[model samples]
Target chain A: MTLSSISSLTLRKTPRISDAEFADLRGFIYDVTGIDIPERRQYLLENRLGARLAELNLKSFAEYSSYLRRSPSKDKELVYLCEKITTNETSFFRDSKQLDVFRDFVLKDVLESLQQDGRKELNIWSAGCSSGEEPYTLGIMLHEMLRMSIIGWRIRISANDISTAMLNKAKDGVYNQYSFKTTPQEMIEKYFTKEPGGFKIHPKVQRLVSFAALNLNDRMALKRVPKSQIIFCRNVIIYFDEEMKKKVINAFYDNLLPGGYLILGHSESIHKFSRVFKPIIKPGGMFYRKEG
Target chain B: MVLAKDIKGADGGVFLAAGTALDDAAIASIAALGAPFAYIKPNPAFTSPEKDLQRIESFVRYYFQYVDPDSPLFNELFRLVMERVFEASQKGWAIPCEYERQAKSVEHLHDLFFRDQGASLDLVKHETSLSSFPDTYFKIKELLDSPASTAADMAKVVSADVSLAAKLLRLVNSPFFGVAGRVDSISHAIALVGVSELATLALGISAIKFFKDIPPELMDMETFWKHSLRCAVFGKCVASLLPGLTSERFFTAGLLHDAGRLVMFKNLPYASVQAMLYARSSGAPLLEAEREILGFDHTEVAGLLLEEWNFPAELRSIIAYHHDPLLSPAPRDAAVIQLADILACGVEISSTGMYSLPGMTQEAWNLLGLKTYDIDKLIRLHDKYFQELTSVFF
Candidate 1:
């Protein structure tokens, strides 16, 4: 069935998710993706997945769940489910105060430590890098920091997200004007080339970062990422329940090099978690540093 | 009409100074120069809402006459919305840190509505957790409202809930009530805080507990409550300026005005974020973005929820029509809540995702009977009560 036909049918009578179906689907989602869908948020799942059901001509969430569990193309459908469940509310230069700390304090601290060890390369990981802005923003900042003599330093910004759709967009290296709301005009002029539909990152800055699809819940997949000096997992962990949050934070801790830094969203705190990292409060924002 | 501060060019040269009355040509030239925003001095002598509305209408007419000279309705709407925006500018309304790249078109609205139709219906039918007011609270309220009931009657209802009685005692003795001696009993606490004030406080506190389940990912509950409390303080302050309106009721009205937003977040977190992002990207009001994204705005949701909760009709109307007070049946009450909401945003209280302060309708401004100078006093009052109330509530 076409979208219009399905929509017209749906318009006649809205499909309702029964309490049993909601529980089944909610538990299924949590088990598969580790996203906690509380009882109150049943409407969100119904709304987002409702479109998929219509497209597939499925009758209810029960049918949709069965299709995922029994279909030959279950892997592809699972990706779609992940896309729907995960939120992608991110932009370039988000929470400027935190970015300032990343640039002024975290980067400075990392660079100083690296210089002492006679190292020239820097590795930064942007976990849950939705649509690429966070990592690219770091790329632009690094380019500016090293300006004329950047030839000597090797920079690697490894960006990852669970959603393939977001990863594709991030890899495309183009963003709309909304991404530049907090960005200064001069930075736009300096680092991005204006394309017809959106601003494209300068090739040089784009080259500094790499994008991949990785779910933080997958411990083995996380191990594939190199131990990094800085890890950014901002605004991502809030979706996970306490156990999942602990698991992911532990993975991040294990993957982080000694003296490495972990930056979370401004509102997020790991104070309740284990004290593997020392919390450092600075003017830019809060960051946790792994003890040596 | 007058410039409140200097407008500077890219090179730091002053284009216009403070206290410059912007003529037609000057306004045109400023717009032509591509200034994103500018602040104007408020008229000191304009006391009545009618006069202020007229002044604002004239200002809008003069300013947009060249740019959108043909559309009278558009001009009127602009003037109404810009009244509080311009007023807020004088007291420091900064340009929001974000803007939307494109306004949602009609086609996108259809797609969104079609997709979320089922979910929207479910939301409408979904009974909020706080549907039933606590029995003790209702009983106490009923006793307080009746002429036959005494302080002893009110105390009897409250003391039935031992924890509630203990809390009431602690609160009345707290610095908020400022009693000379410690109030050890419910009757004493009632006498100290007064029957109506104590009833209102109890109702407010009880209502607050229902919202504790709101996810931290959606919003900081503490910050959200603080903002609600501030709006309540501002609403009460605004009500005090008008005659024949109970200020305490307005305070509760303000407290519950954004209750629908909590419902939205609890049920529609994804869509709520989408609305927020749409608002941020487009630089439109959060309500407009919400309507476009979710097929209904928070005000409508709030109205439905409040109706379900069987709140007072006037209070319900105040919250339901707060965003568009001109359309409200209880216009004055709606206007008070609207202006209080604006003041809450203006004073840098918690925002409902959108950073920009919302504009007020001319009818709302007219209903409040406030002068520009009254704002300073209102802010002072808000500050005094906000501190004390936040301590008591939080």
Candidate 2:
């Protein structure tokens, strides 16, 4: 079928999920996932997640939402659906000012401490690493700053996602040079081994990260993860309603060691949720530390 | 199959005008005769995406066929694509794809003429291996951008690079800038050459560095260096003879006038030299020989090479059409260089050095707005100063 025909058929067959129905589905997603779906933001839900409905061969948003709830065969599909609907825009050394601060303070402090303790390893976690971009970015920065190969460091990174599709991409560490728009050529050349069409992180960087499916709402899965020195749950908790945000923050507080770091996107803050973490403001960006 | 030196015969190879197949017999015959050049009708069936590719190919064929071997069309296709590549580069677009396309087409054409018969077509893969200076250049820019770095500090930065220092020293000691006495160290050379001259010289050296890996055959590296130096000497002499022209920049232009020849010879060595030899033996102009041999001439190559080096567009035009001064968009420093090249050749030959390129007297006479006697005076002045110029560099 022609592209236009397919689009038109899609538009016609679905009785334009009513405003109330759209609201209810958003509410259901937020209730199950603890992701806050803001009121009157059905347009965003429709534009970004509408493709998932079509992919499932569901005639309307209602059927897709119901399938998400009740289908026994939907576990794999649900994971993929979460991944498909999620945003994955990121690159190496993104937000240069923030990176500058990390380079000056955080990385310097970590390395100096490591030198003192005679410990070479450092662990970093990028929770909700959509399409692997954030963790890969982390890998690139760490690889560049460290200069020495990660093989000797025993540096292990844990990247978890609610979406299976994104997890798969993260595990398969292939990326085009385009994904490196913000990255310097020298960085790309140094960190990435040239693949035929693009570049791949060296196996050392790739082996540093482990990808797994995780639902943060499930407390059991949270317990399995080891304490992290640094947690980057950037832009993830912005979707969580206030109460859910508090719960997630509490989990992060329990998960991080004393004086361990927590980073959030520019739009997010943990101050209102709980007083467990204190802010460390630097020239380029901000970070928080778990209170003693 | 012929060593380049031995195949200096008259230019009477096949022209495979429209409709003839580029088959074994035709290719073999063309290869065997080795007349330095032959024209082949661009396969009409193959549509050129650039629309100008065939036109460029045809221009190369015609440039050498009719124009001097050193004319700009000998490697027209290579020159045009190179020009576009450099232009795109200035706009911050690496555009490796377009560069690769040009590299492939030029390599394919070079193979047709150079590779042994029945050799695998894949023998020469296209390379986008042109050295990129984006990062290093940015570093230099950062150094320059610091408000704290004084002009002397900046001059020291230029002086720090041994190559740039050597070139500047050579220019200051050159008769054009050598006021009346010899200028010795980098500081003295900077003072004598002036910041403008040093800036131009640094840029020129960077441009030359870009073509460092170009093969030996397309251009004689030592000879090219000598040619540029000679052209500068002649240009300096001519500019001194004139009033109000930037005499130093004129020498700079002369030093860089035939950069196109370097580009062609380096990348399209077989085609470039084939055109050169054909032009030499046939006594047709160098541009004509280059066109017939490789489908583009020296001026075009120089222009393209300059553009690739990110030299000013005006300078690129000057180099592109140096040999044919009348076709220049505006009067170029190349007119100065052309006059200088021809005058240097005349002086070099008169001083018992063997030379085989176009004559300088005619072009120099036009550009200098001087009579034959005046031309005679300039040549003598170059002959006298050439030794002094050589002493500085040595």
Candidate 3:
């Protein structure tokens, strides 16, 4: 049959990830990145990683796993793998309530402390920033809130993500309309300029933040980050295993200064982990505060 | 046919691996990507129309049951679409391309409409002045509303506008109306279609003129009207199934349900396109996606425009709450339009860049009191009326 005619036949067989291969792959993923894939997520791995395998011209999952283990460019491949596995679903001002708390309660408290001490410096870190929406959102909020007062204050916003691809996107600081879904129009007008493909964050807001590639599992890399008064790590820990979650929480505790705040995802909580931080319940959202 | 084995392209790369359902979008995407052919393991499911229809019904039911299980009308509408699918497959036609590449992200659309407009509900309300009602429309409506008005009174008002008079006669004499002969006289056409129905037709025609200047790049006006006409037909069909309901009003409601969307497309084509793409990718309902991307959805926009045009509260409620019928004051009327809107999308008659049908709430279904068998009959009725009614409107 001609190629055109042969194209009419429907493919019925699905590429199946065997149980043993799935276990091996999941285990390897967890060991390296601390992302825990449950048994039910075999289909997810099969679907997402199967495409990767096809691109790489690998025959089976076994070959793909071995290639990752033995390949000289394994580090590069790992980054690509992380990009596929990690869900980078984030938007500007994703949780308004949490942002309200950040603006109303947390920023006020932090500003008051800094004023009392006559310190002008403020450091904030956004973990798993994912294409820079969270950090840019923070920068915009700070700029709006401080306005004239922001000139004297030294502000540092450091954003880090596990995926280099995402970091590169964050560095570009260009975003589609999806990122501005929850953002108020005035804010968008004030902080973003409409461009051809998407919106570009204003230089004023983009200047306040810097992007870097850092895996949360890497303690040495985490130590390199400057201690911050507030750390926004929302929605990043849901992928980690229980042990990894505790380890990452500990790292956040260490990375935060006394009286610093740790903002997590709406569904995430620190109740299961360390008792070092106190949970502050505000009308908008909950955050953990390290004791002074 | 599920691919039992991998199909290699000319480049020797896997074109489509096994287990992927050869859906229309998949086929189109493969073709777009320059894949020549894919191998498939022949499945018995492809040969059985009954089985295919049953599968599609269940898939649709999964989403519909969430919205309103009490309404059997949605299931019937789904079956109608599936029957079309079966017929198309039997004819060896490729499944129609339903995927939209320029779908807008709902978030962006929301920002443009709501946040940018300072959260005002009046985005499209004042814009109604941009398209004034044709002089003939008001005179015709005035005469139709008057109790003592005769056919000559309405016809005299309509005849003042030569074009509208000609269009009215053509509509009346159309095949769908099944008149004995040509409707040559304006007064005779008014007598045949009745004063109120003629007024409704005039209103629909005049309303369509307002959107004539909408850039073709933003949306195809023909496709938009086809979608509206199909929704009208579906709404009327569903309305007829329910007793004590005016099918004509429901038809009008369905015809103009997505009128607000036209305004959005006309004013903010780029943002609207982004919202469509976002809806398709995220699997969010187009309405919700529109709300997320544009701040307020087309329903709200439609409500504002209809209110500005002095449309009846019932009609406004039907258009405004068609997405969520339970929320409307006129729940029954809203429910008919809502079910019809969903049915239109299910049958692939009209799509708002949504890949899946919006879920029906339990309240909407319970309000309609639908059953499974009624869907089969509705499908039969749809087949009878769709082409005929479409011709009349087009």
Candidate 4:
């Protein structure tokens, strides 16, 4: 074909968003979801919302922003926007190095401190947990490590996400092979049953986890979270800008018990924004703790 | 003369052994062979590509200094310019002149543009009037004005000038226009593309030729036109993104957007240099500096020139409000030229002596409704076309 045909092919069918228009949408997204859209990820916003605009017959992103504001069905559209904007790509046993640190160092230290306190209860909050992989992974680790130490210990994994769709998926507790990229076969066999649809988590493991819809941007809802001895907000804070990151970090600090552990995603760091979360360096990785 | 080492042709076969260059015949043979340099007393000023790369790095950095350092838009432009200039540097384009320009800034300000009445554009228009409007421009304008003219008449007028016809044909056949097949002749181009569009394009090309002798002190002709080529393509790309607008007129308007600035500089060198230096030293924009000294900027000058020349209303409107598009009757058209000019300024490859970027109206840019991906493709397309079409214009 001719070079002109190639040039024409580059012309997009989707109505494009200009820099100012993108900025307006970006600011609105950040205001509502606290998700920071950097200069590099403008395409993500475009690709995700281009079809939504065409479906609504909106001419520009500014018009779409207006629709989100003035339309009576905006609440439904906001949920759809949240679902589209937040990526659900994740796997069980992701980031083995950090998990190794968690399994070996954190489990021993936090448990030892809990035993000293003479409290048999353990509460863990998994913020922005998508598709149930992370919280369920933690549930399996708890079962594997405790191993019938006999009973009477209270263990619950409280998981939350902004997208109710993801919350529903998390409640379903089903997975295919892609979710087990790092989960060893025996571990999968230990905690899951092979159903016709996929691998279903055993009822024992499923009972230990509860899924809920929570918008972290809502300070009141963030306060309503169960106070926990450990909070695993992995890979979630990256979507927030510095201001929102500061807010989320402050909320996570308030929710975490004194001397409790907070494990973030391998790439996420609290040290940059907050000085209160004391760093606990381990052999392979690190976690932070609340210190008075 | 004697050679210190054996000289080989590009294929690595020895053409001359060492110490065998004392005769005129040998020198002529060396000349005929296009041998680059002799090994005698190895030239002292040679530098490595690594050092040249460092110079290019700083030059590109200096050009984009005023931009937001974290911006991906400027970063993409940075890559385009660096690639363009770096490629040229490999072909032995010396860039030391970029640094030496700091020493050449005008020290004293003068209203040199106004002090010489003979050089006044008003006097030139009223008295001399160019004897004629650059030959090809006159015929094109006459045919364009005559209501009775046909597509064949437009073709007759444009084809009378061989180079202008060739330029119009080559431009339409280019990737930007996307004409289906080869346009062999002027009539074929008029048939394929619309007659009025081709006629307008001829006028733009002839206008470029009209300002033939801008003093070397005023601007580098190659750099000026390369910038215009960039703006032309970029404006066309912007127009192409919109639904029903044709892109050729935008291309023509972009080509002649800065004709007023060229005239001001040519007629009043000292004053133009002083205005430029004032903009640089005071950190004011070039247009603002022009307005401060001369009571008007180049757009106003361009308005008078295009109006006096009896050019198309659309072309005149776009060029007149190019720098600030919001005031134009057709803000979208003016905005296309406005944005295209700023986008062209972002590239270090082709400069119009204003190192700083112009402030783009957000409303103007927003009205075009293009995404960054479109700009990315336009930059890539511009890199190819700018290189190909520089020879076509110059």
Off by over 4 Å in 4: A1-292, B1-61, B64-99, B103-131, B349-354
What lDDT does candidate 2 reach at residue B90? 41
> Least lDDT summed over 10 consecutive residues: which range in candidate 4 chain B?
B107-116
Q: What is the lDDT of residue B207 in candidate 4?
A: 84
Candidate 4 lDDT over residue span A124-206, tens digit each: 99998989999999888888877786166788889998888887878888887657756776888888987766789988888
Off by over 4 Å in 2: A1-13, A47-55, A118-120, A149-152, B1-394
Worst 10 residues of 2 chain A by lDDT: A1-10
True contacts kept of 1: 0.01
lDDT of 1 by residue, A79-168 (tens): 888876665767777766568867899998898888789898889999999899999999988888878767788889999988888889
Please write out the lDDT profile of model 2 over residues A221-278, one tens digit for every residue.
8777777777888657755777888887788778886667887764356665577788
Candidate 1 vs candidate 4: the lDDT winner is 4
Per-residue alpha-carbon lDDT of model 3 for A137-204, expressed as tens digits?
A: 99988998899889999999999988888988888888876676667878887888877667898998
- lDDT of each prediction vs. the true structure? 0.70, 0.57, 0.71, 0.73
Error of 3 at B336 (Å): 1.7
How far is A99's C-alpha from truth in model 1 (Å)? 1.2
TM-score of chain B of 4: 0.75
Given candidate 3, what's the lDDT at residue A255?
93
Judged by lDDT against the true structure, how good is candidate 3? 0.71
Give model 3's docking category: incorrect
Enumerate the candidates' DockQ scores in order.
0.02, 0.01, 0.05, 0.01
lDDT of 2 by residue, B1-394 (tens): 2111122234543244434455778666655553324434334576343443333333222212222223221122223323333334344442222112111111112322231121111112221144564333333444445666555865667667776567666766665465557766666665765655565555655555555666643444666677677887777777777777767666667777866665555555444443443343333456544544443566765655455445656556666666766677755455666667665544333222222334332443365574435555665676577667655443
